[model samples]
Target: EPEVTQTPSHQVTQMGQEVILRCVPISNHLYFYWYRQILGQKVEFLVSFYNNEISEKSEIFDDQFSVERPDGSNFTLKIRSTKLEDSAMYFCASRTAYANTGELFFGEGSRLTVL
Candidate 1:
């Protein structure tokens, strides 16, 4: 079975620092997405990428955020400046194909902590 993998399982940073969360989705997946859950809040979509370009993005993905697939096998999300509100569990997800019933595979998540 294929699954998504994330790096730096846990990270602690200062409020004004930068952070990069890495993920590797299934080899054959076509769509990749980044989502986050702020402690007691619901999971929120950040952005989606396909064919090396951004396919969709939520308002949360503003100027302070950027995503890149530096290598064919890896995807990364970078936050230029972290804020206390940025502390949360960031998840990486992927789907083999888009369909009415397609299922998304999610990574264990990289927990970010900002002080």
Candidate 2:
């Protein structure tokens, strides 16, 4: 099956640096979302985008993080500044539709390590 893929399975960056995590989501999908899981915390939704604009965003998606669909198949998340709390696994997910319920397929994850 087609799946979302993220580059650089693991990234180590110094604090205050910029990091751009890339993801190629499945084709023919309508909804895309960004979620993060801290070392010992549950997966938390950061933001959901549709129609080329943000549909919903959680408090965690602050000024530091921004997302964009650079092209047809590519979606990227840019962190302008990194912090120790930002060290976590970032997951890209896509769904065929935003109906009552649908399974969101996620990439293995892009692990971010901030020093």
Q: TM-scores of the models, in the given order?
A: 0.95, 0.96
lDDT of 1 by residue, 10-115 (tens): 9999988999999999999879999999999999999999999999999999999999999989999999999999999999999877634788999999999999
Model 2 root mean square deviation, Cα atoms? 1.0
What range of 10 consecutive residues in model 2 has the weakest lDDT sum?
Answer: 95-104
Candidates in order have lDDT scores of 0.94, 0.93
Q: Over all chains combined, what TM-score does candidate 1 have?
A: 0.95
Please give, for residues 1-115, the per-residue lDDT of candidate 2 as tens digits: 8999998799999999999999998898889989999999999999998989999999999999999998899889999999999999999999887544877899999999999
TM-score: model 2 vs. ground truth: 0.96
